[model samples]
Target chain A: MSNAAFVIIAIFTLAAALAAATLRKLMHAALSFAVALVGLAALFFLLGAEFVGLALVFIYIGAVAVLIVFTILLTRRDVGKDRGFNWAGVLIALAVFCGLTWSILKTQSLSIVAPHIRALTVKRIGEALMTGYVWPLQCVGLLLTAALIGALILVMEEKR
Target chain B: MTPTLQAFVLVSGALFSIGLLAALSRRHAIFILIGIELMLAAANLNFIAFWHFAPQPHQPTGVMFAIFSIAISAAEAAIGLAMVIAVYRHYHTTNVDQLDQLKG
Candidate 1:
């Protein structure tokens, strides 16, 4: 049952990703990207990373995707018409896909025994963050604060 | 019923390639930023998959790494979109193909 679900979700993810890449309308592409991100969250859940999966939904879908939509709204006037199919881009994507698939299939690391599956709890993650990974966590918080300030400064109109 | 590591890796690679194409070929600046987000998600997926399938999964290294990646990407998107807005304010267009004033 879970395997079937995984396959279905993975297919949905790839399809949404393709749409996000190829869609002509910027708004449609952003929506498609949201779908892809949601599918990725589902995939993360299937991989036993429940916290990461939920965070993906909350952060990417809830916050970042909404931010993209807001930005689009703020700058919607100059969206140009679709310029038709990009054959060169498709070719490049296909070549890169081929190379990556070949490399992954040939790698020997795939032969390792499967690790035991264990779902990580939020408490454990919080504990780890506050203890073992505090420095990086602090840095990320600082980066976010700085980014927020910089964005505000960039968007604010200058006083006359 | 679990998917193999190879399957996960292949899917990520495919997603990454799609993202690369979007980043490279899209004329809109926002589209390029969306492509970058896809690429970052793919890399995070790889980290999570490898961590899940590793023999010694006691440590939450991959989870930690993915979390940090998410944080960093969020910051990147904020600053990048701010730049996009600034550019549009000045040049009045978001099409990257036409915003080539920096080209030497």
Candidate 2:
């Protein structure tokens, strides 16, 4: 049952990601990227990490996608006219994919099925964050603050 | 029966390569940023998949890592896009190849 679901979501995600990667139009590519991210979040849900899935949707789709779109809007002087499609990149990506797929297939120890999934509740995640991951959490908070300030400063107007 | 870990890994690998394709093939700076986001997402997927398939009675470290990775990616996207916009403002063009001020 879940196998079919995984196959479906995987295909959807890969197709959208392909579109996002190769699409000539910036807006279309960004929208396709958002779709791909949602599909990935669904895959996360299938993996029984509902909290993480929700967070993915929230952060990626909600925040990042909007940011990309706005940036596209703000910098609209050259849209749908990007030239120079580098073929070397495609070749390199294909080579990397082939190598990774081959290695994944050859790994004998990874043939085991997923163990019984314990429902990792948001409460448990919160507890884990508060108890064990407190230091890292604080660091992330500081990092986010720095990023926010940095972004603001980067886009701020220059003094004459 | 649940799907094997190999399947999930394979999917994420494909995603990662596609991201590489985006980052490499596109001429626009924003597209490169998009590609980077895709790559980071692929890594996050791998982390969650490994956490899901690990042995019983394990810590939820994988999930935590994924969550943190997501946060960091968000920050990266904001900063990267802001830089892109700033560059666009200064240069009036966002095409990476045309920016040759530092190119020797």
Candidate 3:
């Protein structure tokens, strides 16, 4: 049953991602991207990383996707007609897909080898964040702060 | 075929490739940005998969990396979008092919 659920989520995610990439309308692509992110979050939940999954939902669905949509809204550009896919590009993409697929299949076994699902609860993650991985956590915090300031400057520059 | 980690990885690879193709082929800078995001997501999926399958009792490294990647991606998107906007304002078009000022 869990496997079935995983399959469903994976299918949804792949489909949504393709749609997001291929869709002609910018608004439609953004919507598809949201759907893909939701599917990814569901997959994360099934993988037993509940905190990571929920964080994906919160950060992606709530923040990132919204920001993209806001940018689209601000631009007010026409969502032009579908520019037909270039054959050369399609062929290149196909080659890449085939190469990657072959490499992954050859190097690793696909079987579910490890079943030891550790608790990825929010509290556990919080503890880990502060204790063992404190330095990296602090680095991430500083990075985000810098990014926030940078974004502010960029947006402010646009207004002037 | 039964769904395996390989299957998931293959799908991710496909998505990433598609994103790369889109980024390379598209003239629109915003679409290229979107394609880059797709590739980033593909990398994130790989991390989560490794964390799930690794034989360690405690391997939160993948998750940690994903978190940092997400933050960096957000920052990248912001900066890239800002550049796109500025370029659009100057050239009045988002098409990359149209910008030929460096040809001199």
Candidate 4:
């Protein structure tokens, strides 16, 4: 059942990503991106990373995507017509895809040691972060605070 | 390749590539921001996959990193969107091609 759910979520994620990339209307593309993010969160849950999955939904779907949509609405009301597909752009994208596939395939043999699945719970993570990775975690918190202040400054400057 | 892991990686790669295509093809500033978000999501997917498959002492590293990445992404979106708004105010349009003043 879990495997089936994974497959469904993966399919939804891919479809939404394609729609986000190819959609003519910007607003539609943004909405599709939200759907893709939700699918990704679901995939995380299937992988047994429930906290990360919830964070994905809360941060990306709840905040980031909505912020983008709000900004779009504020900045522009109409999405212009499709300007026709650019063949050169498509070719470049295809080239990038092939190159990345080749690189990934080449690295398939290399492996890293991963932790046991049972140790990946949210409680374990919190303990590890606070005990072993405390300094780094604190740094990140400071960084985020700075970023928030910077964002506020930027927004206020825009109004002036 | 194990079927589940293979599927996960493939989907992640496809999403990342689609995002790259959108970033490259779109001249709109906001669209580029969306593309960047897509790429970050792809990276998060990889982290979760590795967390599930690989053998270590800290299984939650991937999850922790995903959380950090998401937070960083939020900050990026805020700063990037604000910049777009500022640029739009000055130039009156969000088209990248039109902002060639610094090209010289």
Candidate 5:
């Protein structure tokens, strides 16, 4: 059943997220973050947003995770350094979870099941991106270009 | 059978809180960025869930939003990690706890 699959993926994601939050080793934590993203993509697939799911896997796991690992490798004086964490932050995260869960449970409107709708294919997404969302897509492209140049400028060696 | 909308929301909430924990608690700058990425993904999950559960799920608004969001987040991660590397070049340390000086 899909419910069982959802449960499994949810548990896997949560567990990997927790590991990423708590792991002492930086590389391990980054890898765990990738795993968590994969599980999230699985949840997206289960929700029937297949294109987004694939994008999630491709971007987060393929691009973002590798980028993080490379950044870690590049900016390193100590690879085996101890990653100290603040217990107060953990307490705050728990408090946030409690508040969110309480509000979600108290709201009766969120109990509805998913509607039977036509599949959201990649073609439809492409069509919308070309038609109604074209401007935003172009803006995003420009933003990405600006980000690339800005990042390069930021990390450029200062001429002494 | 498919789970209810609340179920998906709850999972998203849990992932978000975990991300908050990572972003707030971690000592390394890259770890903080990773946490922020997780938080963004959690929001994307919520958007997709709502789009799926809508009364009339005709528009592909949520999927479009998620795609754009992912794009923006990628840019953000690139810029943030670049900042991390630049700061490391100057300070020679990746731990945020030690980078206390305001003006380098």
Candidate 6:
């Protein structure tokens, strides 16, 4: 049932994330990251966070991933051949993974009874945004506006 | 039955590690940005998972936090890419290891 689906999506997410990190080609890594993000969004949906899941797809897949691909295309040039693999980086990442996995397994505080999931509809989210969380919601709007202007300024060509 | 919270937390930890590897090892600035995005998603996954499984399910605390985080991260991505573009234009290169003029 749902557990099977979760396992499948979780496996896909980890595999895609691994590829995204390990792939040499920038474009391939970006695509793999997109796959990983999509898998995460699916997991969100399966976890009953429907609005956040859809927003993940909309924002990450639709926006951030595409932006990464565009940047890769723009920055493309014939650099020297890839230096194969960086063993030091691999060792560092492996160490971090092993330590984190061990600590996560050893920690007992995370155990909790799984509460029954209630459907989180978009209307409820919108209402929450407009009510209790209104202040942060407005702050987010301001942040986005500032980011847009700043990006334009940064990328704009200077006059001779 | 639903997947346990422990399962979700483990997956997030694994994803965070993968992103850390990419950010640390990759020379390309774009790859670093992609890694950062992966890391942000992992953190967001934790927030959503805890929110979903918390004993008090009546509140939308996790959902609101995740939404704000996602929105802000989108802004971060935009600003990061803009900086990447500026760097590429200035140095004629996007490799982090080569841009060492800042080293004292």
Using TM-score, give the best candidate's number. Answer: 2
Give the range of the ten consecutive residues with the poorest summed lDDT in model 1 chain B.
Answer: B1-10
The digit string of per-residue lDDT tens for model 1 on A71-114 reads 99899997765464557877888899999999999998774545
Candidate fnat values, all:
0.60, 0.88, 0.39, 0.44, 0.87, 0.71
In the range B10-100, model 1's lDDT, one tens digit per residue, is 8899899989989878888888899899999999999998998887787899999999999899899999999899888888888877788
Query: TM-score of chain A for candidate 2?
Result: 0.97
Better of 1 and 3 by lDDT: 1
Expressed as tens digits, the lDDT of each residue in B24-102 for candidate 2 is 9888999999999999999999999889888962578999999999999999999999999999999999999899999
Clashing pairs in 3: none
lDDT of 3 at B57: 35
- Model 6 misplacement above 4 A: A78-85
Per-residue lDDT over A42-156 for candidate 5, one digit per residue giving the tens place of the 0 to 100 score: 8988888999999999988999999999998897676567547789988999999999999999999999987778987788889999999999999999999999999999999
Candidate 2: tens digits of C-alpha lDDT, residues A6-31: 89999999999999999888999999
| CA lDDT, every model vs. true structure | 0.89, 0.93, 0.75, 0.78, 0.91, 0.87
Misplaced by over 4 Å in model 5 are none
Q: State the interface C-alpha RMSD of candidate 6.
A: 1.6
Give the distance in Å from residue A149's predicted Cα in candidate 6 to where it truly belongs: 0.6
Cα shift from native, residue B48, model 1 (Å): 0.3
> What's the CA error at residue A76 for candidate 3, in Å?
2.3
Residue range A1-160, candidate 6, lDDT tens digits: 2779989999999999999988888888889999999999999887788889989999999999999888887878723434445668878988988998898888887765477666777888889999988899889999999999999999999788
Clashes of each: 0, 0, 0, 5, 0, 0
TM-score of 2: 0.98
- Model 1 chain A worst lDDT window (10 residues): A110-119
DockQ of each: 0.67, 0.84, 0.51, 0.51, 0.83, 0.71
**C-alpha TM-scores of all predictions:** 0.95, 0.98, 0.89, 0.88, 0.97, 0.95
Chain A TM per prediction: 0.90, 0.97, 0.87, 0.81, 0.96, 0.90
Per-residue lDDT of model 5, residues B1-104, tens digit only: 77899999999999999999999888888878988998999999999999999987879999999999999999999999999999889988888888888756
